[model samples]
Target: MKVIIAEKPSVAKNIADALKIKSKKDGYFEGEGYFITWAFGHLLQLYDAKDYDSKMARWKMENFPFIPEQFQYKVKSDPRNRDRQDGGAAKQLRTIKSLIKKREVDGIISACDFDREGQIIGDTIIENINAGKRVYRLLLNEWTPNAILQGLNQLKSNEELLPLRNAGVSRQWADWVIGINLTSAATLKFQKGKGQALNIGRVLLPTLKIIYDRDKEIENFKPEKFFKLAALFRTKDGKEYEGFYTEGKEDKFKTKEYLDNISGQLNGAPAIVDDKTTEKKRELPPYLFNLSNLQGYITSKYKGWTSSKVLKTAQSLYEKKYITYPRTASNVLDDSLTGKAAKVLEVMKKGLPFEEEVRFRKSKRVFNSAKVDSHSAIMPTYLVPKSLTRDEAIVYEAVKNRFIMQFMPAAEHEETKIITKLRNADMKGFFVSKGRVQLTEGWKKVENIKSKEALLPSVNVNDEVETVKNKVSSHETKPPKPHTEKTLLKVMETCGRSYNEEDTTAEAMEAVLSGFSIGTPATRAETIKKLTDTGYISALGKNLQCTDLGRRLVETFPVKELFDLEFTGRLEKSLADIEKQKFDKERFLQLIYQFTKEAVQQIKTGEDVIIHEIASSKRSTEVLGKCPVCGNGVIEGFKGFGCSNWKNGCKFVVWKNDKFLATLRKKPTKTMVKQLLTKGSANVKGLTSKKGNKFNAILKYEKNPENDYFSWKMEFDKKF
Candidate 1:
């Protein structure tokens, strides 16, 4: 018998169903000579600084740049209570260990996701258990039954994935070293008050810099005024078109007066066609969706959708076997997948109006092994999903339509450019008219994107036309638009360079091929989410703007290299090289260690500069009420309502997500906090019970006399 482990319970169940292992057991499935188990993402995490040495528990200047001689791992702590181990993760780990040690099991197969992180996740658990059985790795992009069976049949020895494991381990350790040392040092040195932490990471700083720079650019931009001259020309046959006046290659005028004078001269003037050119152009559909491009497309097109949401939805679709792996960087399929892709296209194109056009062909643009890395671009599986949620349907259609477009013909257009010159006027420039007419809506039929036709009248060279109307339009240049999640994701994907949404796939592929990006395709969304959650950036509708704290950190943070895009890109490239065995993991980690040490030193010894201030005046003005225990004023904070005299060791506070309140299906709102502080109890409404029933109750937050910790007590109305 052999044992298999998957990254999550859903995947484990999929594998078991694929293999016909239907006998369910605790924390795993068993049958058909196989025991399949799963982990909740990562069962283990690297040890924190305090774990290595107890003295490192407290943030002290002397403990700066503390690097562990040998890194260690432990079961991840519970998110709610850091001091306690995650019960689920611990129980699952035990289950895996017991199965691995079973005398009947001769081999172990890692069925985790095919990525660096996945490799390490399974590897760490196996290593932690000291499993001596022969190990194999099952690599599959999609969780479909056929794919799972085939992947298991063609498993590679676990040793073959050592390089990927090395890269993953190096990345984890480097992030820990940088994040722990720098965040602690910077927060200690610069932050003036409690609660706020200066979060510094290998990827976070550079990503934050991208938004900060864009925000500053908008703030400093000065709009300029400009004017343009346009004419409405009428052909002899009464065909009409508009043309903008151009002097050489310049169309915009600095002064409206100049364009106004020129507009007066062109009225009623006879114009001769100086040049006319028509060219046929074929626009291929955008390359298949990589994680970054897909996120960019969805976030830019849909309102209220963020990159993080797109990633989650895409991942959900992937796990459901509706699409291939969604966390890939490559935008093209591997040549080996031609047969599979053709079969998929044949199935997906059925019943569609343009099914005839969606013929499969092994084109270099769609299938190029050289362009693919680790995994192919995201494409739907041959198994068409019968149902999906609204968000899932949106992402699924995007991937499905993009795949169908690859097999369809390129969209064709006839681009026409006409240059007309005044035959008798004194103007030195010609009026240029450009238009496009779609010759074929080939791949565009999948998305039902209508091509707007700008038809130009039939005209030959030197054909005469009359300038019937002319106008000089005045305009003021607008400041750059704030960075949206779409644009921000693109900037991160390209290591700080901005690209148009239509061209993001090509540019992002180029950046990925060159081994330069702020974060991996799998982590970019998380980085953006973190920035917002940690208050470094905020969303103004769809636009992302750096917060005041973010701007100050950019301007005042001493370690400029952390904010340098090129530096971060280089480090990212090094990790990629390590995965390919072109760079040594130890050497890469050593460099990170050296950098961390220097950065910590820079923070500790550099000139004292405070970046975040507590805003005492504002806090005083917005005081909720007096603290019950300390008799000091209470104010609302980012996470809770706390006593303003916290510096004096007053522990009287109410967390926003207080556990007792959470059980009642409510979070303490400012209104509730105010009522509680003033009246010693708040009249709460619609609190839910464990049985899914809701009732109104009076709630009070009182200190436990024995423990000196706050707890909530409920009082019912007399009628109840």
Candidate 2:
């Protein structure tokens, strides 16, 4: 018998179903000479600083740049209470370990996701248990039954995954070293109060810098006024169209008076078509859905949808066998998948309206071995889901339609450009009119998006026409728009360089595959979500703007390299090289260690500064009440009601989302804080209990003598 460990319970269940194993056991399934177990993503995590040395438990300045000789692993800690191990993770790890040690088991197969993180997750658990059985790895992009069975039949030895393991380990250790040392040092050096630690990470700083720089650009933008002349022209046959007047390829004028004088001369003026050109153009459908492109398409087209939400939805479809891997970076399929892709296309186009047009043929645009990486682009699997949630349906149809459109003919259109000259006027410019007409719907029929373009009147070169109307339109140059999640993800995926979405040249593909991006497609969404969660950036109706804290950190943080996009991209490229065995893991990690030590030292010895300053201009001057700890005036700031004497080390503040109050389904309001500060306690109604029972109670905020931190105490007049 052999044991199989999957990344999650859903995956293990899928594997068991594929293998026809029906017997269910605690924390795993058993049958068909196999015991299939699963982990809740990661069953183990690297040891904390305190685990390496008890003296490092309390972060102190003297314990600077602490590096462990040998890293160790432990069961993941409970999220709610970090002091204890998670019960579920511990129980599952025990289950996996027992299965590995079973006398009947001859070999173990790791059925985790095929990626660096997945390799490490399974490897760490197996190594932690000291399992001596021969090990194999099952790699499959989709969780379909056929894919699973085929993967199990062709498993690779665990020894072949050393490069991936090295890369994963290097990334993990480097992040820990940089995160722990720099976060602690920055907090101690610059942060003035508790609860908000300066979050410094290898990926977080660069991503934050992207938003901070954009925000700064907007803040300093200067708007300028401009004008343009437009004319309404009529052909001899009375057909009408509008054209913009251009002078030597320049349509915009710095002064409105100049365009106004020109506009006055063109009214009712005789015009002749000086030149006319028509060209046929063909536009191919967009490349297949990679994780980043899918996220960008969905987040930009739909309201209230974020990149994280799109990824989660796509991942669900993949697990359900509706699509291939959704975390892939490659935008094209591998040549080896041609047969499978053709079969899938046949199955998907059976009942579509454009079924006749969907013909499968080998095209380098869709399938190229040189462009593919570890996994192919995301497309629908052969097994189509009969039912899905509304969100799932939206994402599923997108992938399905994109897949079908690839096999259809390219969309064709005719573009016409006409240059008309004012014959009787003294103006030395011409009015240009352009129009597009769809020649063939082709792939566009899949989306029912008919081409909408200006329809020009029938006219030829040297044809006389009358200019009926002319006007000078005044406009002000607008600043660049704020970064939406879609645009931001693009910049992150391309390493801060802008590229046209339609540009799929070999050079563009090379840029994407250069391994210089801020984060992988699998990680960019999570990074953005983390920035928002940590209050470094905020989403204001689809636009990402850096918060005051984020802006200040960018301007004041001493470690400029961390904020540099090129610096972060190079580190990412090094990790990619490590995975390919082109770079040594030890060397990469040593460089990270040196960088972390220097960064921490810079923070500790640099000039003292405060990144988090109470904006007095934004705070209400009317004192809410007296601070319970310092007896100073309490003022309402953006986040909470805090003591005015916060600079004096009095950490008495009632945050809006105080954890203790949140547990009782309550938040500290201005009225509540004022009453509590003056009367020692406040009667808060609608407070909830552990069982979700609601009642009225008196709440008090008092400093704990042991930790010098504030805690909430509740008192009820009568028990229910």
Candidate 3:
């Protein structure tokens, strides 16, 4: 009997169904010559810092940067654990182990998702059980019966996948080392007795830092007034178009002097067409979809959709066999799959509008072996889907249409550039205009898109014309816009570098470089979700907003390396090298270890930002008047000021950290708290109300909680 282990139970079931395995056992399916079982994602994981040495369990400054001599793996322990430690992972492992030990089992097949993490999941179980049986890797990108059978026939030996396994192990260990050490150290030092864990990770910190940086940009932005000049001219055919007046090389000016001088030059002046140039141009179709590009595309087209949602929809399409592997990082297909790609195109274009336009022709833009990586680019599977949801159809059509457009002809266009000039002696004005006319709808025909041309009226070189209109408009330098999931995903994919879908830079494929990105294509969505779930980022509408805590975390953390994109990029580059067998694993481990050690040491000696920020809450006045209830002195505190005898149950307290004040985006001041206790009322300004309107109101103390406790009540009475 041969045993095959898959990533999840659903995948295992799919494999069994494809093989026509009928006999269902307790934890696996049995038939003809196979026994198939599955892992619930990951059945094993690296142990925690304290798990190695119980003394290190309680997080303290001295025990940080805890580098274990040998990282150990065990059954995944979950907080949702039941009678056993690892929820269901322990049971699943035992079932697989028992199967591997059977006398009839001659070999074990690693039929996991075929990624590094997938291989680690299956191998971890086998390694722990000391299974001496021969292990083979069955690489399957899809669960179709034909694909499964083909994978089985071309199974790879374990030795062939050593580089991937080593890379996987290194990533796990590196993440654990940094996450465990830095999180504990920062929490212990900054939070002190506050009990808040500042969760840090290899990828999470940099991700959080990204949102924080944007928030800072918005906060520090200063709006400056600027001016733009435009001249509207009428051509001989009575067509009118606006061209901006340019002064030397400056189009936008800080002062009105340049605008006044330039607009005056063309004021009622005869406009002459100095030059007119037109050229025929052709635009090739975009490259195939990778996970990031696909996510960016979906979110951009459908505003409300996010990267996480796109991945899910794509995964559903993959499972339905309507598309190829969805988690791929490659945008190019292997040259060997040219025939297969042709077949996909033929099947996908059955009822497509421009079916006749799409012919079987291979281009370097679509098929390149060097560009192909672990899996082929996302595309159709030669199975035209009929019953798909709206979202699924959107993504499916995107992938299929992109693939179909690749083999089609280039989009042809007639681009025109016209230069208009005024004044030869008194003053001068040079204006330029551009327009594009679609000569042929090539790939655009298949995409069902028409190019909108900025048509210009017929004009001759040096022909005189009249200025129809002139305007000097005022504008301000605007702050950078907040990050939409589309933009943020691109930023993450490009390692915080500015990247566009059309960018063909060498850094485009630099996914493995540390300075490029922190997480893999398979894990970026989760990292984004984690930022939202942890309150590090707030999804306001379709854009990400950084919260107060998020800002505080970024500003307070002294270990700047954790937040730097270049640092993570370098580390990622090292990991990629590990996969390529170009770098030593020990050196990579040392780099992470040293980084953790320095961070821990810095945190230990560093002053606590949490404690400092809390106690250092900027108060309007240092000390308020005496406590009315206790006749004792009252001073300002982080939350509020209270009678010095509060320890003696005076209860004469004024809370600075009031929920009501927070709702109004206001914080209590020593003077406000003092005046309430001494004079029964105080005048406060700029208080935000429920409807988001700002108003001034008179605040009064009611002394509502009448008991032994001297609790003061606040009320806003007179509003202005």
Candidate 4:
């Protein structure tokens, strides 16, 4: 009998069907000398910090940087699926163990998804079970029966993937040390009794830093002033042209007088044209969807779905074999599959816009095998999903449409440029203009390039037209806006890449240049969500704004040590090295422990003070004012603001009333002190009332920032 283990039950069932294992047992399918079972995601996890030592539980400074000597895993129930904990994991392990012990199973086959995490799950399970049988792994890139059958025929030995297992272990330990230690320290220092846990992870901190930094930029920004001059003209074709101010730096126009002197030279002068140039080119279909790209695309075009949502839907699609494995980093389609493009295109042709765009010819840009790593970016397997969520439909359409269009001919266009000399009375200068004309909207037709706008056409080199209308517009530089989800994702990608210090090899440089990002397609969305759940950021509308707590944390930390982009780059390089087997995993984890220890020490003892800005209260000081309730102690504080009680920790406070609402409300805004000073009575809402309903009077103030006093005039609403 042979034992097969799958990543999930869905894939297990598919494998069972394809292998002709017809008999369904309690927890697995068995027949024809084969038994197939599945794991619920992670059947084992690294020991938690508390598991290392009891002292780690309460989070004390003395027990800092709790690095375990040797990492160990335990058979555990998956946290995500909370329905059952039937010792199912152990039971499966036992069953596999029994098969191995009995020597009935000739070999064990690992048929998990094709990704880093999947590799770890399969390898770890094998290690724990001590499965002495010959172990083989099926590189199942997709969920289709054909893909599975093909994979089974090419099963490779488990030892062939040792580096991948090392990489996974390295990543897990690195995240655990940084996340647990920093989060514990930040929560204890900043949160006080609020107990608001601030989670800090390798990816999460960087994401939060992106948001917090953007907020700081916006807050400290001061608008600058500038001016621009435009000369508008009409052509024989009735097209409007706007000529912009082009005075070079050498022209030295710093004042209105300088601009006026130039304006005087051209008040009625004829503007000459200088140079024109044009080039023709074709834009190939966009590269296929890696997970992050899909998430970002969907987030912008349809605001309803987030990155996490897209990943889940894509995962479902992958497991169902509706598409290829969805977690690929490659955007390039495999060259071998270029012939299959027609089949995918056929499926797409039944759909609207794609129907009009499908072509039999393949485009070189979309068929590069060098760009494909482990399957291709997800594409439909000629199976259209009938029932999908709105997001799923959008993502499916995006993935499928790209696959269909990849085989179509390139988008062709004619680009044109026109240059002319704008002459002054004593000198000559150059002005240039350009445009594009479509020759054939090939693959562009898939996305409807025509209705979408292109650049305007350019005039001939010597073409000249009269200046019809011109004007100068003055404008001021505005501060940057807060980060939206779109911008934040971009920041995370760039920020992580900024830390990349690998040599400028074609792939490494391309990786850096693509600035396409860090974290896999599957994990980027989850990273973003984690940052928000932590107190490091708060969401306002679609914008992510940093709070005072967040700002203080970043600003207070040693920028070089804690927030260095270069440091992150090195870490990325190290992770890559771990995967490549250039570095020792145990040593790398030791380095993380040492670095974390220093960071914690710096956080605990560093004296850099961060003045936390108070929300809701903007005053800087307080002045003397008698308490309304006690009538004894005087309020005192900085920023001319204070509490009602000077002593004994009473929390009552007051702000000096402003009279801006008098005109809007057509009534006098009352002062709380006035209500207390005279019979505890003050006039409010224009017409008046006194304490105890004793008198109807309005208090008229002398209106001075200082030495202001009041007098009461008794009256009724009708006695105005």
Per-candidate total of colliding backbone pairs: 0, 0, 9, 21
Clashing pairs for model 3 are 513-573, 514-568, 514-569, 514-570, 514-572, 514-573, 515-569, 515-570, 639-656
Worst 10 residues of 2 by lDDT: 612-621
lDDT of each: 0.88, 0.87, 0.78, 0.63
Global Cα RMSD, each model: 8.5, 9.4, 11.1, 14.2
Instruction: Estimate the lDDT of model 3.
Output: 0.78
On the 0 to 100 scale, the lDDT of residue 672 in model 2 is: 90
* Tens digit of per-residue lDDT, candidate 1, span 215-321: 88889999999999889999999999999999989999998888888888887989899899999999899989889889988988887688889999998988888
Worst 10 residues of 3 by lDDT: 611-620
Can you write out model 4's per-residue Cα lDDT over 44-91, one digit (the tens) per residue? Answer: 777777777877878886777677888887777444343334376778
Model 1, backbone clash pairs (residues 3+ apart or across chains), number: 0
Give TM-scores for every candidate, taking all chains together and pairing residue i with residue i: 0.87, 0.86, 0.81, 0.74
> Cα lDDT of model 2 overall?
0.87
lDDT of 3 at 580: 82
The sequence of per-residue lDDT tens digits that candidate 2 reaches over residues 578-652 is: 988899999999999999889988898888989975433544677988887778999886667888887556777
Give the lowest summed-lDDT range of ten residues in model 1. Answer: 613-622
